[model samples]
Target: MRGRHCRSGRTGRKRRQKQQSHVDSVSLCHQPQYVRLMRFLHKQGFVSTLLQPALFSDTGRGLQTLKTIKPGQLLISLPESCLLTTATVLSSNLGHYIKSWRPRLSPLLALCVFLVCERHRGEASDWFPYISVLPTSYTCPAYFTDDVMAVLPASVRRRALDQREAVQEIHSSNLDFFRSLQLILSLPVEDVLTYEALRWAWCSVNTRSVFMSHPSNDFLSGQDVYALAPFLDLLNHRPDVQKSFCLQVKASFNNTTRCYDIRSVSGTPHFQQAFINYGSHDNQRLMLEYGFVAQGNPHSVVYVDTDLLCDALKRDRSLDQKIKFLRENDFLNNLTVSSEGPSWRLMTALRLLSLPQTLYHQWKAVLLGQAVSEEREEWSLQTARTLCQCLLQDTCKALDKIFFLLQHCDQLTREQLEVVQALRQEEKCILGSCLEALDGMWGQRDGLLSCQPDVGSVS
Candidate 1:
């Protein structure tokens, strides 16, 4: 009788558990909050964002908590007091961010290796053991403020830093392990720039190789972090740059020796997009959020010394000292740019050159009967129009990039129909991308769409 009762109890418990499981499934299917949360994840990262609508809908708070749960997706809470915005970009590198970066069974080090392989198109015969170990590196800790430190675990304290360009390495035996692998990688660019060097360090320790963002020479002392001289496109480069020239890596290429061999991912042109120098300040903040951002307690900002380049241009008795300065100060050459421009000589020469991007040009236009000065009452509308014309005519990729520039300078207002309407008329068809531009006043202009529904609405 006792044995029979025990069996009956077991059967009853199993039946109840089955009923509970069925109820849980029904609740998950019907939940609205689950739907919204999944949508948010879908829009955020590379892999986590790729799961079909059904998979993540029931994940609930499982994905949102910040116990360092996700690899590529970082959780951050910034005070409303800060002047900065757009801090979401610092979480991962550009080479393999599939638009989603949630953590997985493997750490970030492992995922980066997987990406390097996935992005590679070369034959399997070309994959080498040494080259395969490039992604497991996590030496540099992502830096944050005091508030940021409190939320992380005790183990994480030794991992990140606060300085923008400072390469804050995590205290791990893996550091030495990474250095060993660097000696094996035959990176085309001999010296890895600061960020790239850390990436190389991580890649080496991963026991798997990954794609290098640029060739070894991409971070030349005098070039833009975005492009090399042979490289034409500057905008496709990631904006979160390590703004130091002090760090670099050493590599050797002996493919001929067949000592260790792998096929190369040749450089591709990325010039179709335009990048701006807004990177200078934001790069620091981005690293801060990413846990890889490094800094000191009492921070100091430093810039590249361009005094010699400016002086060289000024002393040259060539065509126009301004042109020489212009070439030297090209925005793409941040490693050689500075506040000093050989002082007055460079400025005066720049003024005389009639460069379109100059106070000289605005003045010249006024002299040539184009733009009117602030002194004249009639100059206001014409000045705005001229500025708008220049903005419209520039080699722009998307309205968002253009709008970003305009927002930096308050002179251009998105609501100004005179400028926007004129632009819409000339550009022919509206690009599909502009509809969602944050800086554009498209919703207000929906009235235009109502009257002409077929009209394309761009930012």
Candidate 2:
């Protein structure tokens, strides 16, 4: 959604001139339409949040405090009727058609189909007000053309390509599916299931939906996953900011209705941008899924795919059996390198990968948390450091090529430039940290082996 706030409605009030990054007076006050909407929500018990324009950045719109919101104050609460959950889709007229498939599709995919069909119905759709506010264009990497996605680093590129492939697959499947049902339903195929329209709906759900687990007893959908929280989804994610509230669905007096509630964990200052932490998501995730990136994200990480690690391990013949073992056990994928050296799983895998054939039988026992001698522990740490050093060297070369491309490229969109720049910075920083950690490990290698069992902190 565009900023949680919109630009409209002003009376005879004289407006104060302010910079584009500063909060304008007109936006600080609720607009007429928003006032009307607030009034309507108030009747439904959602009076705490106000849709106010953001102070900084272009097209700024977000929720602002109407009064001094104290800590533990209930920030917002909406009736369950407002949440667009799978239950809504299962109850829709399109539900029967979705159920006609031999093996049922995932709740998310089924919801996508329902959304497209409902959208085609225009004003007749029940959630038109919510749909009307959804942004037409999402800046997520999935929305980017292949050429633009190509400029991104391998870590982001892999994910973007995977998403692209998934979207295409879903689109093709849904197209074939709806076409088969067209005659039975007396509906035009193109009007309901076009790739462009489906893509829009998919992106909207991907970017805006919040995870609100449904009650276990509810039989509507197997997965207790994402739900659209209409106006609440407009708030921008601030990973660095302190969280103001948590969301929940609770039953009303007679348990006849469930209301969506935002219970404040801390007080929000008046006129300040209220933010929700979308979990400790890395920059790649935020950029790929949410269509925006937070500068200086502490959770930022660079991924080291297993294929690269396997290539490096191939040099050591002693690791052959161990590498095969790791792959067979499913521990060879999704390894990550962050500011704090290698991830625990990657480090453990490397430790096992470097173990001598004579001690290979101990791998399972060690993984089961059995105690190992100090010498063995030091050996494992040393082996892990060595493997990471090799990884760092290879990563540096890859980064160098990307750097050169970024320096020489003449034409790039603002979004592409921003993503590339952030990727380069994060990757370089992670590699630099790895190199520094390895150097420290090397310095302590002799001391650790000769004088004491203690190895200096590797992280």
Which residues of candidate 2, in runs, are more than 4 Å off? 1-55, 58-61, 90-105, 121-126, 148-159, 180-188, 213-224, 243-257, 361-417, 447-459
- The residue-level lDDT of candidate 2 at 457 comes to 26
In candidate 1, position 51 carries an lDDT of: 15
lDDT (Cα atoms) of all candidates against the true structure = 0.27, 0.62
lDDT of 1 by residue, 241-302 (tens): 22311111111223344111111112112111111122333222323332122222112121
Candidate maximizing lDDT:
2
Against the hidden reference, what TM-scores do the models get? 0.18, 0.72
lDDT of 2 at 341: 72
**Which ranges in model 1 have alpha carbons more than 4 Å from their true place?**
1-321, 328-388, 395-459
Question: What is the Cα-based TM-score of model 2?
Answer: 0.72
| Highest TM-score against the true fold, candidate | 2
